[model samples]
Target: MVKKVTALKPKDESISAYVRDLIEKEHRARANREAAVVYQEFLDKNPEECAAMEVWESAPLSDEIEPRKP
Candidate 1:
């Protein structure tokens, strides 16, 4: 899916533009993670829910989907 860039220019720019950049990136990453989890949940779930994870992983590589493991 193509995501069009939405500019968020807060008047006065309370924080610097650099900080805004960080916030935007982190937000996107967090949202992606939440989405991935919807796919990862396996046990204790209904049949269809468990299958969702498989569907996503089966797709071709496009971008980083997994969270950084320490």
Candidate 2:
């Protein structure tokens, strides 16, 4: 049987908090979809750079430890 999933707010959580969480989740999903389209275009234009792009993506991110100096 297929299961139906539902989002349950905590007993002590307020309505506004629940709504905010839902909105943030929706925004994150939308951003990921947009990013996928951009990445696809990049690949289409630079198929030869796939290896370098993969290496860069696999590298650990350092943005959190040190902000870019610009």
Candidate 3:
């Protein structure tokens, strides 16, 4: 589940700035939706390539894990 936390009003007192921020947020959301559609279409066209491309890469942090001894 996703949750949103609203930010407290900043000291900048400019309505124009607020409107600009809303516009930017809307544009970003629209772009993400469009990209999702394109990605789906690509996967439909090339399932094998898409499967290969879908691998997620990340680096591990914090070497903290319960150590086991054999």
| Best model number under lDDT | 2
lDDT of each: 0.66, 0.78, 0.70
Write one digit per residue (lDDT tens) for candidate 3, span 17-64.
766787899999999999999989988999886767666333345658
What digit string (tens of lDDT, one per residue) describes model 2 on residues 1-70?
A: 1121123666677666876898999999999999999998988899777778889889888665777889
Off by over 4 Å in 1: 1-15, 42-70
Predicted candidate 1 versus true structure: per-residue lDDT over 1-70, tens digit per residue? 1122224454554445646787899999999999878755643366775577569779889867999889
Candidate 3 structure lDDT? 0.70
- Residue 51 lDDT, candidate 2, scale 0-100: 74
Quote the positional error of residue 13 for candidate 2 in Å.
1.0
Return whichever of 1 and 2 wins on lDDT: 2
Q: What is the lDDT of residue 56 in candidate 1?
A: 76
lDDT agreement of model 1 with the native = 0.66
lDDT, residue 20, candidate 1? 70
TM-score of every model? 0.39, 0.58, 0.58
Q: Answer with 1 or 3, whichever has the higher TM-score.
A: 3
